[model samples]
Target: MEYLPNIIFAVALIVGIGFFARNVKKLSRNIKLGKDVDVSDNKSQRWKNMAKIALGQTKMVVRPIAGIMHVIVYVGFIIINIEVLEIILDGLLGTHRLFSPLGPVYNFLIGSFEILALLVIVAVVVFWIRRNIIRIQRFIKPEMKGWPKTDGNMILYIEFVLMLLFLTMNATDFQLQRIGAEHYVQAGSFPVSQFIVPLFDGLSESSLIFVERTAWWLHILGILAFLNYLYYSKHLHILLAFPNTYYGKIKPQGQFNNLESVTKEVKLMMDPDADPYAAPVEDDAAEPEKFGASDVMDLNWVQLLNAYTCTECGRCTSECPANQTGKKLSPRKIMMDTRDRLEEVGKIMDANKGEFVPDGKQLLGDYISHEELWACTTCNACVEACPVSIDPLSIIVEMRRYLVMEQSAAPTELNNMMSNIENNGAPWPYNQMDRLNWVNE
Candidate 1:
C-alpha cells in the first residue's frame, strides 16, 4: 500500500507520454501524406540551417524586445524543466528530493531552475500584454479571431500557472524543511521561491505538508497536461522546428520549381526533328499527370511541413504587400488552412482505417482560394520573415501552378501573356512583320 503513490505516478506518466506519442504518430502520417520531393542534397548546409534557425533562433531576434522576451520564456522554460527529471525520479521511487545526495550541485541546479522559472513568469506576462493590452497588430489579425486567440492566451495562462505552482511547491517545501518536518529534506536552493517561503510561516506542520504535497502534485500533473496539449497547440513547433528546419527548402528563395514533364514536352516541340514517341527521360516516369497542388497530397512534403511548423505569428502576413494593400490573402492564414485541411484529412483517414474517403474538398478551392493564391507576388517576403524557416510562398506557388496548368484557370492577363509568348515569341501581340513598328514610330 505504501508503494501505491509511486504506482499511480508511473501510470500517469505512461498515459501522458503515450497520448503524446499517438498524436505525434498521427502528425507524422499527415505530413508524409504530402507528395515526396527530394530534400536530400546539401547535407552539411541543412545541418547548419537547423542549428542556426531552429536551435540558435537566429531569425527571432529581428525584433529585439519580443526576441529577448521569447528567449527568456523559451530558454528559461526549457532549462527549468531540468528539474522535471528529478521530479520524475522522485515520484517513481516515492522519494523526497532524490538527488539531495549530489549536495551543492543539486542546490545550484535547483537555484538556477528557480531563477529561470521566475524569468519565464516575467516573459509570459510581457507576452500576455503584447497580445492583450498593447494589442500587437499581428496577434489581432483576422486569422487570430477565434480559437487561435483563445489558444494563444490559454497557453500563456497555462505557463503562468505551471510556473507559479513550481515556486509555490518549493516555498511550501522550504517551510517544511525549516520546521524539520518528516520527509521534507533540506535540499534545493530556491533563490526566487525563498521570498515566497515566508507565506507558510504561521501554518501548522500538517497544513504546510498538505500545501506542499498539493503544489507538488499539481506542478507535475500540469507539466504532463501541457505535454499532451502541445499536439493541439502551435507550441508543437518547440519539437518540430528541428526536423522542419533540417528538411527546409534550400533552393534560391525566388526560384520556382518547374514542371519537368511540361518542360520536356516543350523541349520536344521546339525540336522539330526529335522523335515524339521516344522513351521518356528519367523524370517522366515519376512525374505526376496533374501538374500542381490541388490538395494537401499534391503539395510537396516540405510545404506541408511548413504548414505544421508555422508559429502563426503573422510575421509572414505582416510583411506581405498584398495584405498591406487589403488583398484577402494572408500567408499565415494559408499555412493555417493547410494545416487544418491536413488535420481533417488525417482524421478521415484514421476513421476509415488508414484510407481517406473522397471528401469533395481540396486545398486549392476549398481551404485556400483563387484570391489568396493569386494575391501572392511570389515575393518570398514571408519566407524571409519566418523565424523557423517556413516557406508559405512555396505552398502558394504550388497551388498557383494548379490554377495555370490543370484547370486553365489563370486570370486573363496571364493567359494573354502566355498566348503572346506562344504565337509571337514575345509577351506582346506584334508579329515578326510588325516587330519594327515601334522602332519606326
Candidate 2:
C-alpha cells in the first residue's frame, strides 16, 4: 500500500510535467511564428472542423493501407491508457490486479488491449520497413538533410520495446496465477501470453517476481518518455494532429487570398491629391513599390505557422508533377524554404529590424525562383496529397497575382494567354467574329 501511493505520485508527477513542457514548447513556437490563431471566435465552425478532420481522420484515409495502420495505431494509443490507469490503481491500492472485482469486464478490456498492442506493433514494423527497406524515394531524399532520421528510428525502437514489454508482463502475470502466487487473471483468453507461460514454469518464484517488476517499470517508463519525446520531434504529430485538423480551412482548396481593395484611402497613401479609387500614376519618375511577398514578415502568420505544422511526410513532393517531370520545383523545398525564411525574419523582427518588405527583389525572384513558381500547373495535386491539408496552391497564386498585376513581369506565354482572355473571352487566339465562320462551316 505504501509503494502503491508512491508509484501513483511518481507517475502523475512525470505525466504532468511532460504535458506542461510539451504545451509550453508548442505555445512558444506559435508565438515566435507570430501565429494569431483565433478559432475560439467560431466555436461551432471549429467544432465541425474537428469532427470532420480529427475524428474522421479525413486526410489520412487517402492512402488505404497507411490509413488503416494509422487508425489502429490511433485507437490503440487511446485505449492503451486503460493499462496505465490499472497500473496506477494497482500501485495505489496494493493490489496485484486492480480490476479483480470486475471479473469478465476486466478480462475483456485486457484482452482487447493485448490484441491492439500486437496489431500496433505489426503495423508500425510494416511502416518502418516500407520507409527504410522499400526505400521510398520521397521518404529518404537528400533535401531532408536537416531532419534527424535517428529520431524516427528511436521512436520505432521504443514502440517495439513497449509492445514486447506489454506481452511479457501479461504472460508472467498469467504464469504467476497458474502457479498460485496470485489468483487474479484479469484477462483469461490472451493466447500469446498463455502459449508462452509453459516455458517459464521452471523459473523460481523470486525470478518471476523480478521479471514482472522489471517489465512493468520498463513498459510504464517507456510510454512516459515516448510521450515527452513526441512533442520535440517530427512525431509532434501525435499531439498536434488533432488541433491542426480542427483548425484546417474548409473553404475551396484552390481559393487564393483576395487582394485588398484599392480604395480612396490606399490611393491617398500611394499618391496625394488623386482620386483614391483611380489607378496610381505609371510615370517613370514615380517610385513603384514591388508587389508579392518581399520577405518572411510580409507573410500572414497562418502561412508561417503552416511551416511548423508540416509533417514532412513527402506526400506533397511525391504528387508534384513538376518534380516528377524533372523540373526544379520541389513542393517539399518550398515548405522548407518558407520555414527557413520565417525563422530568419523572426530573428530580425525580434531585433527590431527596419522593415518587413525588402527592396529590389521579390520572394519569387530570390527565395523561390520564378521558373519554379511558373512551373506549377495550379492542379491542386500537392494540396490534395498533403496529409496536413497545407494549401500551397493559394500561396503560389497570391505570388503570381503580385507578379502579373503589380510588376507586369509574367512570362510572355502567360501574357499572351491573358490578352487572349480579354480579347476572346477564352485563352484561344481566335477572334469572337470567327466563331460564326466555324459554325457556318
- For candidate 2, write residues 20-96 as lDDT tens digits: 68665644554345434344556688787667766777778888988889888888888988878888666555666
Give the winner by lDDT: 1
Give each model a TM-score.
0.95, 0.75
Can you write out model 1's per-residue Cα lDDT over 87-176, one digit (the tens) per residue? 999999999999998999999999998888899999999999999999999899988989899989999999999999999999989888
Pairs in clash, predicted candidate 1: none
The local distance difference test score of model 2 is 0.70
Q: What lDDT is reached at residue 266 by model 1? A: 87
What C-alpha lDDT, on a 0 to 100 scale, does residue 252 get in candidate 1? Answer: 90
Clash-forming residue pairs, model 2: 4-91
Backbone steric clashes in candidate 2, count: 1
